[model samples]
Target: MDDPKNARRSDSLDLAYNAALTKLDVATCEAMAVSQAIDVENSELHLGFSVQIFKKLCSHSVALICAVPRSRWVKSEFENWDFACAAGQSRAIIEGFLLFLYLSQTPSCNAEWTAKLLVLYVNDCTRRAKMMANVKAVDAAEDWMRQAEELKDRLKLNPWFLNLDGKTQKRCLAGDHLMISSRDEILELAGWEKAEFYAIWDLLSQYAHVLPMSFTRMEPDGRGSGAANEADADYLTATIAWCADTLHAATNRMTAGFPSTETVRQGLDSKFEPGPKENRP
Candidate 1:
């Protein structure tokens, strides 16, 4: 015998998904309007290594706007939170990529440095992935080690790359060792200071993870962080508020020339303009 309850549940889920898709379409159109304003073909545009980050930066920005659900019925005791959680994760990544676009303005984002950093990042990530796949993933580990050696050799091209630590810069990255010590150096080369990075982008990272302190902010009553049948209105408003702030920051930082960025951002913000709080069943 087929259960009608299951069918109703499926239908409700489909409705919720479709509502998010509708809102996602609005966000997408807004993002597209902004992207078209750029002239990537102009010879004066110094978007060599930066272009790569540009595409990813846009993707992250788009993902951020798409994760907010638009429909009122998305009210679930807990299910509605899935997208919010994902949005936070995407937010963290977006913050990092925005930093890259900012840095691409400097010599650090040049082909030489980009190549070395890419190798180190990719190889180190793969080695870690393989380590998880197989405990004795020695080959992956060795490959990363070799690339780290090559990257160290290239660092000499930019002698002042490690100006922060001076002569005692104990900087050689080895097996399973990432070139993290040079991160501040790269930021400095991009005319950005470490204090600003820590204050702005780095601190929000805690929200990206399922940390113990995060749980402290949640409540099962649906009135708290989890989900509320009616209180969800508050959460949705808050999410859109976040999207607007980040979008503006990203627009200012990356300069993607999104013509409709301001308009769409304003429109999105309009969705959450202060109104009577709806918290009824």
Candidate 2:
């Protein structure tokens, strides 16, 4: 028989995990509804881009939601869970949420938005060029690079882009994303503290990158089976919490963009807050 104390812990974790999952589901639904309702063709460029970003975030949320049950099944059937894989997916969700917040929101100046779009276009071209070059498609790569150069020239011509410092201007021309604001500033816009978010991000990064920290502190279970146990539960709960928080934030931003969704958004009462070092043992 399970100890009474352990049973209580299990019950509590189940409740918390379920609650977080529900919040993620509701938020994602809200995002999807908003995405479908928006007329991207008629919207301004910034608004259209925002819709696209929000749609991507919604897709990430859906994948995470699906992974939760799959992880549970793996733990029960195979007696093992892929925590590292989930960590990487959670990191992607975090990044998508942050980026959606950054690009979807109205900028102080329209020109800034235009400049951002141009840089993104240039980055896309540069990435495609590199991919083609990797496949030894020299002519295709050169064509992509030429298009990127044209974008760089256009970006340089923008008054807002030219107003940036010389170093920033150079970075923009080189296709650096996130140059619109410092990392901390972008997090602040999403109501996240830089230190706290970075701490969790660093922890997730360790697993995502398969770093030594991810495996150095492996404590064996009493049964000598390193399968499903409290440690895995903790990691899974923390991942759920992170997904809930990020999707919640994204939902709020989406509602702001499409006020009609606010009613449905407010109906989601369950919310999760992730601390700076959540799940870090």
Candidate 3:
């Protein structure tokens, strides 16, 4: 039987989740529009070394926007948990983009950074492929690993791959040395405050991992169903809104000089300069 408290909690959660989805939609649109400025007809966007990174930012943003699940997706008890995990992942992507852009200093992007990014991407692909044990996909991951090395060599990076430790996780080639940065590392790189970042990531991970902390917050009916309370609504709303703000930053860096983003002004500016395409790897 459904308790009044449970019903009230479910209603609140549904409303909050729907509202958050709308905000995510707006953020995605704004970010895409900014990218369009760079991709304008005949304008000839010259992403050069940062092309892959830009593409990743756009794709991840789209993924997050597409992840706004509805009632049908919440049939199971763990449905909300799944959605919450997606939110955390989306948040992490935005953070990575921000830190990478800051580090690239891309007004004059170069091959070294591009090669490094490719290496990181390959490593991530390899890690995921190995984790899942899909034979065909594993072969594809090997190809990506090979391509990553080629990029490193093309960039004249000596001692490209390194395996200091035997453990796959610890193994790193020369390019791997600079590939992906952890969340803490990105925080240091971006020089942004961590209050919001830690709060959002930690709170979301509770649901994503099915921690006892998360369970304590759920209003469970006698049946297997459950609903989160007001705090979930408040925190999720804030988290998604912040994600939109980060997306705006991405668009700003990606299309800094384009006419489309002319009106999109903010205090934070990177030394953004379009680089020549001659050194693309």
In terms of lDDT, the best-performing candidate is: 2
Instruction: Give the alpha-carbon lDDT of every model.
Output: 0.46, 0.69, 0.52
* lDDT of each residue in 1-281, candidate 3, tens digit only: 88999788778776767776666555555555444445444532234445446556656766555453442212333434233635555656655675446444542334434444555655564555454456566666666666656654544442332321334324334433444344566676666677866776776667667666666545454111223345545555566666666766666666663555654332122122121122111
- lDDT tens digits, residues 1-281, model 2? 87999989978976775676666666655555555555666666676777777777767766666566433212344333446646777888898777777787687688889888888889899999999999999999999999999988888789988898998787778775644666788888877878889988998898789898778766665111345556656776777677877877776766666666555433333222221122111
TM-score of each: 0.53, 0.81, 0.57
Residue lDDT tens for model 1, 1-281:
87899677656655655554445434434434444444455422335344455545556545554344443324333344432444463455445544454444544445535534643454465566566447766777666556655655565454454443543334333334344335566556545567866653432354456555444555665533544333343334444444444444444543544333354343233222111123111
Error of 2 at 36 (Å): 2.2
lDDT against true structure, model 2: 0.69
Global Cα lDDT for candidate 3: 0.52
Model 3 TM-score, all chains together? 0.57
Model 2, residue 38: distance off in Å is 2.3
Q: Candidate 2, which segments miss by more than 4 Å at Cα?
A: 1-3, 70-81, 216-226, 261-281
Model 1 residue runs over 4 Å out of place are: 1-30, 33-46, 71-87, 108-135, 160-207, 224-226, 229-242, 252-281
- Count steric clashes of candidate 2: 0
